[model samples]
Target: MADVRIIGLDIAKSVFQLHGVDDAGATVLQKRLTRARLLPFFEKLPPCLIGVEACATSHFWARELTKLGHEVKLMPAQYVKPYVKRQKNDMADAEAIAEAVTRPSMRFVGPKSPDEQSAMMLHKVRLMLTRQLIMITNATRAHMAEFGLIAPVGRGGVDRLLAIIDDQTDERIPAQARSCLQMLVAQLRLVKLQILDNDRQVLTLARSTELGRRLMEVPGIGPLVASALVACVPDPSMFRCGRNMAAWLGLVPKQNSSGGKERLGSITKAGNRYLRQMLFAGAMAVIRRAMQGTRRTWLIRLLERRKPKVAAMALANKNARIAWAMMMSGEGYREPMAIAA
Candidate 1:
């Protein structure tokens, strides 16, 4: 009712709860609205600061609220948790959101655009399908091994098995067993086809986007990585620096400090799991090729001393930092200096 200074919205699928505070931090309004009524209610309110927990559908509302002349801040759910008082309820959560948004040091999630969210959803679906395909392939191989049939270990093995099943002269395999293998082979083929199609779609989308095109210049970043980066990070400027970006990607080591002594552990492994996995895979690929070359660069030399897995992770960390620099500076990848001979 009074001049609204801040409004904390606890959003849900159908019902939404709002807690409003005035400029003096006194409670001004508390109301509930259905999903359909949410926007209309905000449109009537004078332009004020609105805060919401970063979750499903939050971005959509953030964009909508922004368009209605309200300043929107999306706080990560974890950051809001500390501010929650004794009992956790809609009101409490709303209050926590209000408190969290006001903190100067609070890190907020940049609201993603609809297209960015769509791209991310597509990547998630592709990842699920790829996992299913791997499970099916493994299951088929394990099942065949029980019947004295040894399938090869990789994709080539799947093709070989299918070829064997198709062969008329393969009398070694029982007729019924061959029939089952035939069915599995058909399914495997379909899964592979789907995977390829999804990959192509992702690649096409990445090539068409500006950010994706820029990300592609990085050695290990292919179409998938480029597109994933574009989908995951809505605003590159949100990261203060390259290191911040790397830390956000969970590529940096975790730190523990006590008595003025600092201890560092393995990477935090926080943030987008899919992007982290892709970066690690890319790192592995780069390491494999670098090993074959005679160039004794700093990274290559480091790889020689550390375990392959450790080296791979180190490269991933470096790549993450490089990615951040590229994204933030709007520049392409540049080769680092080599140690003087």
Candidate 2:
């Protein structure tokens, strides 16, 4: 450990590989350490630059390493991929990270705070539970339909079934079918309760933050969307402009350019899927209100002439830009120009 200046750590659950370089970009140390020995190894070394990919647990370690006085850089995995040499291995990957972090133009991800990570984990749990509940509900409905009994679409149908089960004199449903419906209704109720709890958690988290408060001023950005945005984007300054923010969120269209002609395709859909989905959902909500004359201006007028889904996506992109502006400018959401709507 001859005054290591830069160290690249290839992290894993049990074992970690380290590639250390001196001030002159010469390999000074290459070592493997178990999870238990990682901190101890770094504890003996003077504070230096450490680099890791922005994957699972990266932020946690970044925060930990920062606390230990090391400068940590979390690079996106894609950005480091090009640096990989002819063969890819833990040692090679560690070396690539070492090399990548030394570049003057390298961009690194800002490590998310504990609170942001917690909110993100809650959102993930809520999404998983909601998907499971939907699957159960659909399976129950399909099973019922096979017996010449059709369950109506949407939650209303589930409510109707629950009411029938509670009724003392309803004979339309057979006993066995009633039993199954009762079971499903019970499960649905449990899931709905969990969803309410998750929503409350999201709201509670959102209400305690300045960014969340500002985001609330934006139309259609409720507790969930605000919290997700806050969690996903730890540092808005990472983006140079609103368009950079939109591109980071994968709201921008993919471009295919050849010769002198340029064509743009659908959104890249490359970043956080949960955040993108929440933004799209918020946009759809806004579009619904816009459709009802809530805002009859240029954007709305243009939307009226295009497919609703397309308009919704366009609105989502606009909302991403506005969000970026609000974050960067330290201002609340403002209505777009009257003509632009």
Candidate 3:
């Protein structure tokens, strides 16, 4: 047990599978420990390298394990999948994690701190409330439209419809519809307030640091993007280049090459979906403004040939690269110079 140099841990809510290999790459320990016994077992073991798959609770365990004088590496689940030998089981997964973490070229996910997780939870809650608002708003609008009461198609329109519902003598909508919509309207108001609160919190966090301010200087990055980036990424140095960071967010194109011929397709759509969604939203804001002018941006040039949606994606990719570069360089965004006439 003392000579075991590397252990792969398959973490779970209750039982944890541990596969420990000796210095010569020989299996020395294959054990399953209950949740309560897990930490004490490691506490008695000498300092060594521990490998685990990066999943739910993996970061918490990794953070805890690190405090035990052990070096821990969290491998992405996809990267470890190839190592699973025969039948799939907790032991096989644990062994696979052990093998994958030993590979020289394997990429590992860094464990996120408690604060990072908390901020992500905030973003998640905000998104959930926004979705609920959309559902109720759409249902109310559709239901009211059935009774010959129709309005415009935005939140503004929803507010107008709510006003109509509140009016007792509006004969267009039946009383039953008014009753049903009243509940939805109340829920909508509550959700709107909650969303506003989340936005204010994000904005406050963004302005709390000079780093966030610098990030916001980048085009297409607002308070939400700036704050989310700060909370999620603690070290930009993990990526070798700006494009690497962009690619990690699934902004870069996916590729398939054969016989030295390169074929590129849609983006892999991997990595953090929330960050990607935020970047795409920011890009759309820029595109909305660009539509009003004939001013040729690099984006405008692309828009001339590619579709507006494609152009928007290209701009989002560029913004991701730019944002990463700014984070790495600690420099504020500099406006691009006009192309030589």
Per-candidate TM-score against the hidden true structure: 0.91, 0.91, 0.94
Candidate 2 clashing pairs? none
Highest lDDT: give the candidate number: 3
Can you write out model 1's per-residue Cα lDDT over 100-181, one digit (the tens) per residue? 8888999989999888898988799889888888887887777677777786677778777667778979887789888887
Off by over 4 Å in 3: 171-177, 338-341
**Most TM-score-accurate candidate:** 3
lDDT of 3 by residue, 1-341 (tens): 89789999999999999999988999999999999999999999999999999898998999999999999999889999999998999999999988888999998888889988877778889889989988988898898888877888777798888889889998887787678889988998999999999888888878988988998987789988888888777778888887888888898789999999999999888888998899899988998899888888778888879888787788888888887788888888888872243
TM-score quality measure for candidate 1: 0.91
User: Which segments of model 1 are wrong by more than 4 Å?
Assistant: 164-184, 337-341
Residue 259, model 3: Cα distance from true site in angstroms: 1.4
lDDT of 2: 0.86
- For 135-234, candidate 2 gives per-residue lDDT tens digits of 8788777766666656578788866656766675777777887787778878878988998999899999998899899998888788898888888888
Which sections of candidate 2 miss by over 4 Å? Answer: 162-183, 337-341
